[model samples]
Target: MTQQTKGKASALFPLLIFILLFIGTGVLTKDFSNMPLNVAVIIAAAVAIFMNRKVKLAKKIEIFTKGAGHENIMLMCIIFVLAGAFSEVAKGMGAVDATVNLGLSLLPANLLMVGLFLIGCFISITMGTSMGTVVALTPIGIGIADQTDIPMALAMATVIGGAMFGDNLSMISDTTIASARTQNTSMSDKFKTNFFIVLPGALITALILWFITSGSHINQLEDYSYNLVKVIPYLAVLIVAILGVNVVIVLIGGIILAGAIGIIDGSYTGTTLLQAASQGVLNMEDIAIVALFIGGIIGIIQYNGGIDYLLHVVSNKIKSKKGAEFGIAGLVSVADISTANNTISIIMTGPLAKDIASKYNVDPRKSASILDIFAACWQGIVPYGGQMLAVAGLASISPISIMPYSFYPVLLGICGITAILFGFPRRKVKQ
Candidate 1:
């Protein structure tokens, strides 16, 4: 048996510093943009290295570098780069515009709200990012609300809810990659597990939207022109990913296909395609750097027994497998609320959740699902969260105004909690 390390409260000081620095700056400045997450993590990493004086500075640096260079962390960074490239290439080629227009063109006037939600879901799943989906669809949603009787807040909420649906279950989502890798589970497996749990919530949300908007009628219907050919890359990526192909291969193929399509359609020249790909990779630089910093900081903390202390305390309070699952859910939820970023929350909480799953005999896939679902649940509704802030900004309304109408996330939480309490979708633990 491996030797057990004693838990130490001081080991967590670095993490506390990160949270305080990140949240305090946002609160004080009333602008989260004032303190970037990567900068906060770098500061925290510095503090972690400076602490634990008995350990040689050289040894601390080694530990931090080792964590940053860990296989899973490196893989995640690579995937982020590739995902960014594909997304940017696809968008550069007009895939996002085509997809949005196609969905809008096909929607029935009576079911406009429900149609917006479904379109948001499809875009986010294919895009593998909620922020992109919200940005692409919020304007359309705002237009729909302006032309129809739908409340602006409800319309914005619908877009956010749909975006988060895919955020929780999309195979290419960073949250999926982080949760699956940290727990040593396959993306397809986690997607399947997550799909069933969130399906009920999604359906209920659709029904609720339809019920409310069924009586509403649009003042005028506008036709949006789109070329279906531009949407093939997105469809190809989604299909191949769901078929259990390797994620890295899937992303590389997507980038190539999107670039080729863009080139053939005259949407992008060779130079522009390369430039788009470069810009896409650049867009992901901050998150990728943050991931590395977080890995290093977490490594230092774990080496100093912070994680052991966390596990010891959690294991004591969590008496059953069910409780362990709840603990994982709560842990990520709090992390998401604090960071206002679901991807970062998963990165921070995944290791601890993995440990909890191992001790409680909870399926890694289930643990990953819980981590994604709960983080997404809070992310979709938190007033300060990116999704809410983006949609609220687009609608020119308060983020709090969108909260009550965020039915999908609220229902998603209910379904996730119910799955844990009832052990729904029972299956044998993977060997």
Candidate 2:
């Protein structure tokens, strides 16, 4: 027990070092874009290795490598690569334009803001990736802003909020998969809990958008021909994913489908298709590197006792089930803030959340929901996070500029905290 406690306490140092290095440099520079997260993570990994006095240097290196190569970490890397590939290929084939035009054709002028949000939600849910949704829809949202009276930041925020909605609830979402798998819960069970918890928030966001953007005039898609065939890949991915297909398979299928459609449509030849796919994978380099470094760092910390120490410190004040649930929410929120990736945060905190839930008899389903929701909430709003960064790049606006308009995450955070404080969705009893 003494040894275990020591390990946990020791693990925290590396994590703290990472946070300080990453967040500190960003704050000091006043430019998050200048501070590379991957570098911070690598330095933290080095600190983790140096702090491990029990093992030889070679052994420590092996441990670090093992952690980075863990099955879960590798799976996430694969997903990122495939998701990037699929998104890029689809973009190359003008799928984003097609989707944007299709959505424009269906909505009334006054409801453009709300329509953008809803479409983002649908695309994110269908794509099972918030970044992908942002990549695909941010341009469309910007176009809407240019065409209508809506502000650029407001339009982009709508896309972000909607993307987060799907990221929070989509079955194939990385956060969902991480949460359910880590908590030993079923996706459907967690979805039932998560869906209802966020439904009110989603509805409120839509209503607010409608009221705010009511005066905006809609712009017709003049001479914009949308090919419906271009949308089949997203639809296929969503359909098979909903039917319980493996996420990797779903993404791979989507990539192939999009590539085939692109080729047949004369959008690209075989060589250009490969180039697009390769570029897509390259786009994910930062995240992929961070994931690997984090895996290695976390592995060493776990080996030395970081997670156990964290669990001890986090749970020390919890007495009731509600407190335990709240602790879980706080755990993932902090993790999300530190990492700036909702899916990665979920993966990191999930095991500890499960432990807390089991000890306090908190429902696993609720735990999973809380994990995904809070992570998504924090990730959606963090200016440095991938979602916000991607949108910022596409919209040519500061990520923080979109914060006030990020109604979904704000509402999500409110609803989530309220649920924990008030103990909504009372724990179910096993028959």
Can you tell me which runs of candidate 2 are displaced by over 4 Å?
Answer: 1-10, 108-113, 116-196, 208-223, 331-406, 426-431
TM-score of 1: 0.66
Candidate 2, residue 238: CA error in Å?
Answer: 3.5
RMSD of each: 6.8, 4.8
> Please, what is the whole-model Cα lDDT of each candidate in the order they appear?
0.80, 0.78
Query: Residue 8's C-alpha lDDT in candidate 2?
Result: 53
Q: Candidate 1 lDDT, tens digit per residue, 1-431? A: 12335579788899889878876787788776577666788899999999999999999999999988877668767866676677678878988677656655776556888888997888778768776666556656766776667899999999999999988888888899999998899999999999999999999999999998878865656567789998888677667754556667877898899899999989899999999999878876766676678778878987898866664554456768999999888878766754566897799778878888888889998999999999999989876565675565545565656888999999999999999999876877777
Which candidate leads the pack in TM-score? Answer: 2
- What lDDT score is found at residue 428 in candidate 2? 75
Can you give the TM-score per candidate against the true fold? 0.66, 0.74
Candidate 1 residue 121 Cα shift, in angstroms, is: 7.5
**Which pairs clash (backbone N, Cα, C closer than 3 Å) in model 2?**
7-304, 7-305, 8-305, 11-306
